[model samples]
Target: MGCLSATRSKAIHKIDIPALDWPMARFPRYKYPLEDYVHENQQEDAKCLEETEDLIHKYNAAGKPVAAILVEPIQAEGGDNHASPEFFQGLQQIGKRTGAALLIDEVQTGGGPTGKMWCHEHFDLPEAPDIVTFSKKMLTGGYYFKEEFKPPQGYRIYNTWMGDPSKVIMLEEVIRVIQRDRLLENVNESGDILMKGLTTLQNQYPQHINSTRGRGTFIAFDGTNAAKRDSIVNKLKLQGIHSGGCGDKSVRLRPALIFQPHHANIFLNKLETVLSNL
Candidate 1:
């Protein structure tokens, strides 16, 4: 059996769980605004890539070869952390060299929120990942995989209660709706409004906010600290906006594909009110 391993990225929810004795490499903590910190972010990427390769090698030499490396295209629960396309491409190459299957977890970023069915599509990987997992908006939890990952025996993938097949029926209708309504296009349109509004808010309230980042409508911004973040979320909730916080002090925006430009405007106005009061 291969040794289990994981990345040391800030997937906040993992903090309370008992983890396996696996080697973990740091995820790049890029500085923002991304344009101004290009060179530094590049160096950060290089450093993380090096550490990942080192850990893979270290584990292999220890006789527990890593069989796979799993990652989120955008680290959603991890403060909406993002890595450049170059970073993802590099990671793919490293995984290939190390004989590790690259597994992308698209549970949060999938189903058109990032204006793509799969968030990793934006990375422009040379080829598809060896495995892709999805659930959330997908209507049912499942995965896709390259032939090599398939087990030779039947029942190997069984669970006590197979997920409802009825969900698949709903999933099919959901796909039809997305395509017929051009919801992906709506995602891009709404995303632009939200991103721009967040940027404006950050500029107007730099003391309270910073590090606004995301793609399509899958966005997030960090507060100066956790208390401020919670306060902002609470205020927004009172105003009828149901948003949430993640990764310690970041506020995340996970809107439905049906969310449109006008909806974004309402959200922006409410957000502005909350920030101004703060």
Candidate 2:
């Protein structure tokens, strides 16, 4: 699996658990306000892609062939980090050249958070990934795969229930609601307002926060420190606006797709109140 995060410098999750000695490559750390960081971010992309290729080669030469490479469109659990489309495109090419099946994990950023059905769709990959694992917003856990990845024989990927059929029924209703309410459009509209508010807040509180980033309504910002981050979350909750933190000092926004512009304003207003108190 390909692991990406700046917070690795802090600690690795579940290090006590036994894990395969797989090759881990660093993903890019792009400067925020992506448009302004184009040149630098491109360089960052090249660097990470090169490191990935080198690691794959090194492992293969040592007779530890990597069967697949796993990545997240937006490394959600790893601090809501993001990489560029060009970066993802290059990684796909490298995976193809190296004969490693490309797997995109959309556990958090899928189901319209990034203004698309799937975050990987934003990359404009030449073809679908070999595997696409999803859950969270999907209201279930499963994966889609290219036909070639299908098991040649039955029972290869079976489980007691495989997945709950009841969940499927619930998902059907969820899909209906998404379509009936045009939630994707709502996601886009609310995301615009939320991001603008975040940018303004970031500017106003530069000493306490920075690195405001995300697509659609999936947003996050880094606090000055871990304590400050936790305090912000706690304060927001006490004010009746719940939020979450990831990495060491990042607050993530995970509003539902149906969340409207007015709801975005309420969140921002709560955030402003919290910042003032902080």
Candidate 3:
């Protein structure tokens, strides 16, 4: 059980089923407009990383030496939480020191949502992770490991049909189109617009929304409260602009890579109308 799987959703895991008892380390909860709180955020990162090391030692003392540390580049389902590159780099060191493999789960933050092919790419890891898993936008569910994690013998891990051939073909074409059309560029462009517009809205309607934060088009802002978040999402849906809520009162925006400036403008305008009405 020390070769752990941190795969459960932070929201509903308690109500679902019994889980292995793995100690949870604190994830850095940063303040909104990250640039404004640089020192505080850095300290938060240090605090969380220190706790992670402490947990590893505690688990080791219990005779269950930690074998792996699984994390997300951006904690999407866990309210889209994010940690600094330094935190992740420090985590990799902890894994090395503790002989635990570093596994990064990218099911939600993958496929160029954060203006990067993988969200961790933004982290600037000194080396590749021990294991990286992908799905959803990837159109296939699979994991790739570093050479060391590969099977020692043939057929140790085997799969004939990876997934539906149709999905594979579509995935290939999707990658091609993304490259040919330079959709990542488009994501950055659109994301800039969206973030700027959202920040303005946050300032303009502080009571309705705040804590606007994100990278590229993977954006989110907090509602005044949970009820207010539900109301805002519902109102946006009524206005023909789809939106979603995650992680308490945070409204997460999962715009496609191809989402253009015009689309961002329309969405922002609709959001403004909703906030104004609220």
- Provide the clashing-pair count of each candidate structure: 0, 0, 0
> What ranking of all candidate models by lDDT puts the best one first?
1, 3, 2
lDDT of 1 by residue, 98-192 (tens): 99889898988878899888999999999999999899899887888999888999998887666577888899999999999999999999999
Q: Give the CA lDDT, 0 to 100, for residue 144 in model 1.
A: 88
Q: Number of the top candidate by TM-score?
A: 3
Model 2: runs farther than 4 Å from truth? Answer: 1-16
Between prediction 2 and prediction 3, the one with superior lDDT is: 3
Write down the TM-score of every candidate: 0.92, 0.92, 0.93
Instruction: Give the candidate number with the greatest lDDT.
Output: 1
Q: How close is candidate 1 to the true structure, as a TM-score?
A: 0.92
lDDT of 3 at 174: 95
Q: What's the CA RMSD for each of the models?
A: 2.8, 2.9, 2.2
lDDT of 3 by residue, 134-184 (tens): 998898886778988877998776667645688889999999999999999
| Model 1 steric clash pairs | none
Model 2 clash tally, residue pairs: 0
TM-score, model 2 to reference: 0.92
Q: What value of lDDT does candidate 2 attain over all alpha carbons?
A: 0.86
